[model samples]
Each structure stands twice: as structure tokens, then as C-alpha cells.
Target: MQKNHHFSYVIGAILILAPMLAQAETKDINQTKFSKQYAGWAATIEQTESEDMLATYPASVILWAGSTFSHQYNSPRGHKFAVADASHSLRTGVAIPPGGNGKSASCWTCKTPDAPRLIKEMGEEGFSGSNFVDLGPEIKSVIYCSDCHVDGTAKLALPRPHAQNAMAKIGLPFDEQNISMQGAQTCGQCHVTYYFQPENNNKVNMPWIFGNTADAIEKYYDTRRFYEWIHPISKTPMLKARHPDFEQWSRSKHADMNVTCITCHMPTVTDKNGNDYTDHKVSGALIHFDQVCAGCHKSKAQLTATLERNKAEVDAKSRQVQNLLVKAHYEAKAAWDGGATWPMMNEGIMGIRHAQWRWDFATASHGMYAHNPKEGLALLNKAIEQVSAARDVFKQVSSQVGAAKPVYPDISTKAKAQAAIGYDEPAAVKAKQAFIKEEIDKHWHPVATTGY
Candidate 1:
């Protein structure tokens, strides 16, 4: 193991005990069951995911870089590795020319508690365009007590401006007076979809100006003509979806029954002393299904099988769309290469852009397969329609160019597809390793003792 991770190791160890922490009039941010000691457990959960987190980045993401996740994407390791992971990710500011705009400090906004604190101290605009490397030492910790706590006391707080601003736009506003909203808002801080608003100092903002569903947010992005990048092959301007767990959960049946994420992910755990506190491991609810859902469900076995079935069905539908979507990108590239003009290509490219956005938005929530499979399948249906429309446009261009049939290139594997788009996997891997050693281990966030 690398040295100088003393604090990280401490939290890593406590997470093994299944941590329990924090509460108030907020029964559990109701703050009903929280004590400082217990809150450390919450901090521990915040600090580490305490499970094997490596190599779980989805295999189907062969076309990953074409979307928002960019060069590299992985299953998120909990807060303990937040700073390190960001530094190590090939997606974050690697290979940028000096003075060119790479990812800004705004990219770090959700990864560390230090971000909000620094944003408050330096002003959001002041922090926005700053270099990611320059902010490392100051941001030397992951999500912890301070991210959601007020002062040194245990009173729950809202530190994320993105969450607060987004909530207000939805008309609920920031009312600490309402503990239920407060509890969910804590998770919502980083769990919702957001885009960096270039009009507003590159500060992060949610795409909920119109509403919460996948298409509503798409309409919102449309109003602004906001997009992340052009697909290298298709030349389509595209929008990248971030995780939208909070948004999907709000529309879930669980939400209708007054269940928040904490009721499941942070279920109450009783100690040997017979006192109950929330589990701080912060794992998937399905990991310990009985702990959270056993009270309501009659047969744990049947429920587990049902949830898994839901996930499999969503995954199958998504994969089918993904195969078609990948084909559309290459097909658009063929049209461009054949000297198809914008008039002929615009419709095709737009179709690719819209189709991919729906897929990214729907599947971005890892839990959507189980938590809101209906919504997931619905958005995917739209993806199918959009990609098919894109293909129709591509076919018209192909025929007009005297190339009646566009032969699909053989990009059946990730390596082939990446090469088709001019990405260098080996170089990217090398750069990420070098960056982690020189930047992360030597100069990035040092784990905090208080995190445990």
C-alpha cells in the first residue's frame, strides 16, 4: 500500500464494523438519533465504501469516451478515494495543452467537502475556473461531517449551493424547518444530474429548470442549447447525463410511501449496547435487503429475485439500444466522409445526439434498473426511436451520395471501436498511472482523521 494514508486506513478499518452515526430533531438528519460519535460512523460511510470497488466500470461502455464520462469511467469508490480517484481518472484534465481549458476546479465541486467550504470562502466564481491541480492540498479530504454539519455542533446543514439552488427552483426552497426534505436533500446534494453552467462562471447547476424526468431535463438543456461535446465520429453536439438518483427516486413508488434513501441505504442498526443508529457503510440497499425492506415485504427471497429480474430486463433493453446507437455514430461518420453536406447530415446528427442523451440519462442511475425499471425502459424506448430516426437520415445521405448502402464497419470489440474514433487506450492507461503516483499519492487529498 502507498504511504501517508494513515487517516484513510483508519476509516477503512471502522467501515469493516459497519459504522453507525449522526441525527437530530431530524430523526436521523431528523437529527433524532445522531451523536458526534455516531456521526463519525456516517463520516466513515462517507469516507469509504468498504467493498471491492475496482474493475466494475461497465464493459458495455466501450463507447464511453464518446459520451460525458470521457476517457475513463469507473464505479465510484466512496469518499475515502474520491480525491484520489478524480486525480487518477483519465477523464479529468489529462493531456491538455497548457493555457487550454481543461476540466476546471468546478469539476472537483462534488468530490470533496473542501469544495463547498472553499467556494464559500473564495466565492463560487473565484473557484470555478481555477486549476484542478492547484486545489489539491486545500481539498485534502473526502465527504465528511463538515460537508453536511453546521460548525462543530451536530446540527445538520446544507453546504452544497448546487442542491440548494436546484431545490429552490423546484419551489420547495431550502427549508431546514422541514426535516424530511432536509434528510433527502443531503443525499440529493451530489446524486442529481447537473451541468456546468458556462453562463454562470462555470458553476454547477441542475437541469431541472423545467422538471425532473429524463425528457423534462432534455427540454431544459434544449432551451439553453447546452451540450458537453460533439461526437467525434457523428459530429453531433451531445449532452452527457450525470447520475440522477435523487430525481428518479422522487418519482419512485418508495418516494410515494414517504421513503427516502436513508430508510434503505442507511437503515438503523442496533449495537451490543442496544442503542440504534444509522448504518454508515452507505452500501446498496440490495446488499442488505432484509435490513431495510424486510419490514414491508412478505417474502425476502421473492423480493430479491424480483428486483434482480427488473435489473436484467432493463439491462437487456439498454444493451440493444446501445448496439444500435453505436452503429448510428459510425453511420453518421460514413455520411460525413462521403461529403454529405450539413443539410443532409444535420437531421441524422441531431437524432444521434437526442438518442444517446436519453440512454445516458436513463442508465446513469446505477439503481434505475431496480429502483425505476419502468422509467428506465421508457427512456430507452425513446432512444430506440431516436437512433432509428438517425439511421433513416444517414440512409438518405448515403443514397444521395451515390453510395446506396452504408456498410457497417467492424467495431465489434472495444479496442476496434476505440480505434475507430482515434482514442489511444495504452497511452491513456500510462498517463493515468503516472498521474496517480506523482500527483495523487504525493500531493492530493490527505485522508482526514475526523472522517472516521
Candidate 2:
């Protein structure tokens, strides 16, 4: 009797909320636009992605130029583009490592649904250290339902070992008992910032020992002295923040209300057959605010306006900090070129590195402002403050070395900026194109040409 009453109460509550949800624009929830097949490299640039993706920055800063990211970077299209993007990206060049080498298989971990199977065949460490080319032919599926769902059932599964290890570190165990966290963890599996553990076969590990906050992660990196690469111009050890969507959203207002990532991203919808199911399109919540927020929010238009206003504020601050950090890098280079001693350049180098790290942490997640406006703006302010201090150090150093003020160069365009940082853009594109013709074209069918 109690169970029946509880179920009735839930249904009645949904009925009451339906009128409130109807205030927003409606959608045909049955549609699925993205293909099940692999979307090759051309689709990422020519069709689905915006040109602005490649031009997110004014130019290639020294930190990016020193890393593989400068070779090719974009806003991710969707699950369909996973395997093809991983395989054909200029960053993951055709460098096949020898036996016992790492970083090869680590790249594919989050890009394919075949990961669990491959990891089962080879241990987590073995898979992480294996040659990427050796597993090429075996790559069959892109990210799909099996990644989070049970093989024959719709039940969710937390099969990713790396994700499990990360949660354990933060004292959140992934098991059958914690179904609510499991829903979010499925997305957290890839969305959180992580690094290749150098000593453990380059195994992917999240720096969650301290915690998930930006300060905690940065402290963990500082204590461990884990740097992604060294900037060529500033010679500062730099950190590259991978998409930290999970980290940004984990402690958000929505999360505080027990709203999981699935609640917003994969909203419930009915099929043509009148059967209801969770939509797997997996897009930003703002796109379908009616379906996601419903009774919890006002009209979609008002909510969207608020979100956009917040984003604009965050974007402005980000641009300000980015320009300052870029100047710091170039000014440090000027100090080096002018024969400044290591002691003189030390403060500026460390400042730029730390500042950039914070900036990237806040900006890397495409929807950071929407996810957590307070945290996003806080991080950008820190970046602005840090970069200003760094600029002071550079100014003092330049004077000590009898050098002129650093003149910002002609990096108005992407090509020009990358060139300024000494990255051969033409050569990278040419090589990537050749690789597609020879390797990718032969195996994968390019279905992403349409509706991309």
C-alpha cells in the first residue's frame, strides 16, 4: 500500500510540473542525427565543427606550441567522431612505439567503447603501455551504449578501471549501492582532468588525492612536480588541462540539489512507439532546457538569457587574462634573448606557468560558466592577478638585462600565431592529410559528410 502511494505521488507531481515545463520551446525527442559509424578527420573541420575551434586563442602561445595540442585541436563533435578523431588527429602522429613503451594505448582509452574489452584482454597497465598501432585493426566500436550500460540489460555499469581508481582516491566508491553517483561517474570517466602516470606504464590517473577543486589539483601537481611540457619561449614547466567538465559540474548548484549529469544531458523522452527512454544525444542542457529543467526553472527564454549573460562575463575576463599571460610568455622570451640570468627570470617563469594553468582550468570546459559561474569567474580572477604579478617580474628583468619592452608580434591569425611560435602548420596538415588517405580511408567509411 505504501509503495503504491509513493508511486502515485511521483506521477501526480510530474503531472503538476508538466504545465510549467510547457512554457519553453518543444522538441521532437525521437530524432538521432549523429551516425553510428566513424566520422573521419575532414568531418571535424569541414562539416560539424566551427572554424573558431581552431582559433580559440589569438595565437599559439608558447605553452601550446610546446605541446601536441597545437598540432590540431577542436571542440568535440560527438561520440561518432571519437575513434576517427583519435586516430587521425595530428597530435597523435603516426609514431608507433617499441615494446614496453607507453602513451600509445593511453590515447584511445576514452575514445572507444572497445576499451573495456581491450583492457580485459590486456591488464590496465599492459593496455596503457601497448603499441597503439598493434591494436589498430581491433578498433571496432566508437563510444556507445555498452560503455555505460550492461551488455544485455539497460542497467548502468561502472566498468572503467581508471574512473573507479579516481573515485576511490576521493573516498567515493563505485558499486551497486551508489547508483546515483554511478550516473555521474559514467560521464566523469572521461570528462575529468587526468594525466599519464609516467612510472605506471603511463596509466591514466586523475590527480584527486587532495580533491577535485582547481586549487587542490594544482597543489597535487606542484607537490608531485608533474608537468605536461616545457614552454619553448618561457622555458616554464606548464600544465595542460584536459576537458575538466566533470570537475566543474561536480560541486555545482545542480549537484548540490542532487541533479546528476544524466539529469541534465540525457533527459527522458518518448519514442515513436510511445515507449519512454533516456535520449543519448548527450548535449548541453541549455539546448533543451524544457526537457531538462522543467518545473525547477522559469521560462526557457529567461533561463537562457541568464546563462548567456554569465557566459559573456566569463568570456570577457578569460580574454583579459589570456592576453596578459601571452604577453608574459613573450616578455620572458625577450628577457632570455637579452641574456638575463636564471635567477632574474625565475619568478616570471613560474608565475606564467601557474597563471596559464588556472586560466586553462577555467576555460577548457566548454560550458564551465553555465556549470559553475562562481567557480569559473573566481579562477579567471586568480589568473588575471597572477599574470599581472608575472608581468611585473618580466618588467624588472627586462630593465636589469638592458632589454627593450617586449613587442607583441603579428599573431592576429591562427597560421601567423602558430608560425610565430615556430610550429609548421602547413607541414602538419599535409602529413595528417597523407595519413588519412593511406590509413583511415582504407578502413573507415566517412558517413559524417552529411548532417555534420
Question: How many clashes in each structure?
Answer: 16, 1
TM-score per prediction, in order, is 0.84, 0.84
lDDT of model 1, residue 240:
82
lDDT of 2 at 188: 87
TM-score of 1: 0.84
- Mark the 10 consecutive residues where model 1 has the least summed lDDT: 50-59
Q: What CA RMSD would you report for each candidate?
A: 8.5, 13.4
Q: In candidate 1, what are the lDDT values of residues 45-138, reduced to their tens digit?
A: 4544433211332333444546535455666665556666676666674534577666778888887788998898889887886767667668
Candidate 2 structure quality by residue, lDDT tens digits, 1-452: 99999999999999998987884335212112222111221223333553445476655444486887876777776666777767766777753535444246888888776778888999888888876655665677666666786654557777788898888888877774366678888888988898888788888889999998889999999998888888887888988888888888887998898788888877676666886666666767876677778678878888888888998999898888877877888898888888898888888888887889888899888688788889989998998889899989988888888887787777676777787878897887787677566766665445311232
Runs with alpha carbons beyond 4 Å of true place in candidate 2: 1-47, 50-52, 60-62, 95-103, 272-274, 443-452
Task: Give the alpha-carbon lDDT of every model.
Answer: 0.72, 0.76
